[model samples]
Target: MRSECPVRAVASGSGGRRSYLVTGYEEARLALGDARLSKDTAAFFAGVDSKRRLHPAVAHTMLAGDPPRHTRLRKLVTGAFTSGAVAGLRPFITRLTDELLDRWPADGPVDLVADLAVPLPVMVICELLGVPETDRPQVQRWSAELFAAGEPGRTDAASYAVAEYMTGLIASKRLRPGDSLLDRLIAARDGEDHLDEDELVSLAVLLLVAGHETTTHFLGNAALALLRHPAAMERLRSAPDSLPQALDELLRFDAPVSTSTFRFTTEAITLGGTEIPAGVPVLVALGAANRDPRRFPAPDRLDLDRDATGHLSFGHGIHRCVGAPLAKAEAHIALRAILTRFPRIRLAVPDERLVWRHTRLVRGLDSLPVLT
Candidate 1:
């Protein structure tokens, strides 16, 4: 099973279309940020399968766009998560965190993913988007279905349902505008360069999915990392100032996202001395990239003080995660509070018994059992 190649040739889907599974950090970075490499595969290739079918709603995000449009769309709501905006949410986030912790049974066991990790992001994102409290469950259900990898049919239906729902949500925001990110985006303008209807809807899709899904995985992964490193946990609990650095290390140690958004080759080019022809797909493995020997010494070890900020957990280049600051704040607050309040927190079950989501795209546990 072992191979001796920097890049390996791989078959993609039913057709014989080729792809290179990139591993080296610098190589992957070069490939990912390269201008010749295109994110839109369908534009260059013939009959290539659109990965969007798996989660069309998520696909509608700025992730799917390139250059000018992507630039404009990301800029529209840039002010929404500004330091001031994030600071404003801190009070609400703290109250929400305390309420969740207060509700924790204080006895035997609980699934963190189910009880805290999932709902926190959902509620926060819903609040930011001004989604009604009553409508959150529906949104959560649609998101779950949309992220279901094996159930393509269900995912397709969920994607359509959410898109329809969001379209309505955007319309409502337009009519009864609030101070939410959605409303601000609708009203936002940069010298008359306003987002069109489709752009606005796409931005909404990005926010809704990213709001919950990525953070949920991050918190779960972070909890798992802490559970794996008891020494690190003890150090963190003893020195709470280390929480931010530790969180960054956790992100680099085992990034929640295994791969970057798929990059399709627009024209033939050489990468890492390998000639990759045009009309081919490429996936940059962030998990592998983070652990690359050249990038970090003792790559697998969780060093709380290691400079892990530049890690590709959020992504790289122009497509870097737009919600990174928000995600970081949420994770930091959640982890800090969990550690500070539940000083004796530990896993409810053995580590080996944990079940990881099989889908390679997202790295997360199906359930995180914990004891307080």
Candidate 2:
């Protein structure tokens, strides 16, 4: 409620986990960049042995990390994310999009979630990471387990499965290497930085999961938003050149992430006129921040021509998603190709009947049925 106060302390109903929710646009952006914030989230798992706690296999700390460590971990992989590198993926992404669409049901309702939105991103990421075709299904299952609303034990099991898989994958890469992203990361790991085996696995896991999951949500949510707004959809279908800006608007209108990753303050800090004590967990609501009327007039309306550049879809600061370029390229190719192939696409079912995958971290449709 930025209208009343930007920052409000809230408690979860499930775990009763206390967190500060920052809902204002400017406050959310600034809070994300606050130096007093620390990503070392082990403090959340209060009673467990810190060594045995959840240690993600990407970016060293998943979404948490401050400083030179975050700098070093991110730098090792930044070389391959240049504009040219991501642009180079255009042809591959286009080819994959066409191939996937070719297999879509030609005569009846099409479930975009299963047929296109889900598999396409996973396939692209799999190929990029050199994950074998046979193993893709298992990887997808593990990824779903981590994101889906489920019991804690089930999610933990899924996390362990993914970590163990990545650990083995990294070990194999050390003996026999290729030019894939995983191979490059392995080389960096073994290089002068002395990146440990665990960190190597973490990075791979992060890449494989984050690389496609958010993009999957972006694809699904963007499509649904476009379908709901026929004027914008028709405009993009006719003038595909403007699809990039349209995608940006779509992301802002309905951000893929509901909230930013947890950030705990290292010291007392004032945010949005609210003083947060040291070590309080913070949840920056990206979805709410994007819709702030102060920043975006008529925040509920989708305007393809609106200047939505500053939207937090890719986040801001060093913690911003490293795969933003790749994600944008993939979404662009996916949307453009869809428009060209299915110019008459529309929702197959009533909008009210659609169900959402309402997880704590991800916001996406369970299935998006469309007709062409």
Candidate 3:
């Protein structure tokens, strides 16, 4: 599709909106960073004043926003994820990885999603936000709802449940402070800058939701890629330092995020010689872009040694994931440890039996059962 038609009109999204999808590498790369594209959906949603229509708390996330608002929200929370701050988590993350691996079932089909991938990031983000271990299951359940495509009511209920929980959590943090990221956010001061009540809750939920969900998919996809490609796996095992670059190739080969989040043009934009009119929704196929043969040779095959530097797994432009470093650190350490510990790890079931997430928003395994 990318080679034949880089940009084409599609009638696939919900709410009866005209949509456009871009699949070429250069097209998606440029569109993601395009100023003409806006993330605010007020102009598209039906029957209400976009300005006065109070979007859901989770909707306040900066990933779905444009500048100024994005700038301010990003600034308020940027310090918590600085390279130094994220790197500071290495020891704790390493310890956690070892602990989880040690607990894996000795002689059975272990669901790696439940055993490692899911829990690893969930625990990390929870700890970062000072969420209790006891509350992990509940938060995990609610967070899973974000991927419940075609089930608006379910996702809504899930969002509300998290919002209610965070309200209490925030109130408690206000009373009894701790040295967690939540505490930092609660008291995060940038001269005269700070988060209001809504912003605080929104940011917390965003971090918790995005913090684990994307990373979980990434870990799953990357693990599956390496497992299917033993040469790549063995190479990483012999030289663990190569795991970093190998991760990039794995990401490009199978991006966790199949499509970039909702983007709409403010004015008619021409891309790939296709005329996209104003107010049309645009979905950039990140996974497709990563595999564009015009850009990366042998794009479908997994080449751990490939220089996959400019992959869109973390996205492009200012809207790029802020927790990218932390996610990479988690994936890097987790994958290395998994491969190192279970040198003979392989899927319990045939590849054809595996199921993928039904939603197009994310590309990941529904469950990855493995024999460690």
Q: What is the C-alpha lDDT of each candidate?
A: 0.81, 0.84, 0.87
C-alpha lDDT (0 to 100) for residue 137 of candidate 2: 86
Q: 59, model 3: CA deviation in Å?
A: 2.1
Model 3, TM vs. native: 0.95
Q: What lDDT score is found at residue 212 in candidate 3?
A: 93
TM-score against native, each model: 0.94, 0.95, 0.95
Order of all candidates by lDDT, from best down to worst? 3, 2, 1
| Model 3 global lDDT (CA atoms, 0 to 1) | 0.87
For residues 282-337, could you state the per-residue lDDT of candidate 1 as single tens digits?
77888888888688888988888799887888888887787788888889889989
TM-score of 1: 0.94
Span of 10 residues, lowest total lDDT, candidate 1 = 48-57
Of the two candidates 1 and 2, the one with more favorable TM-score, higher being better, is 2
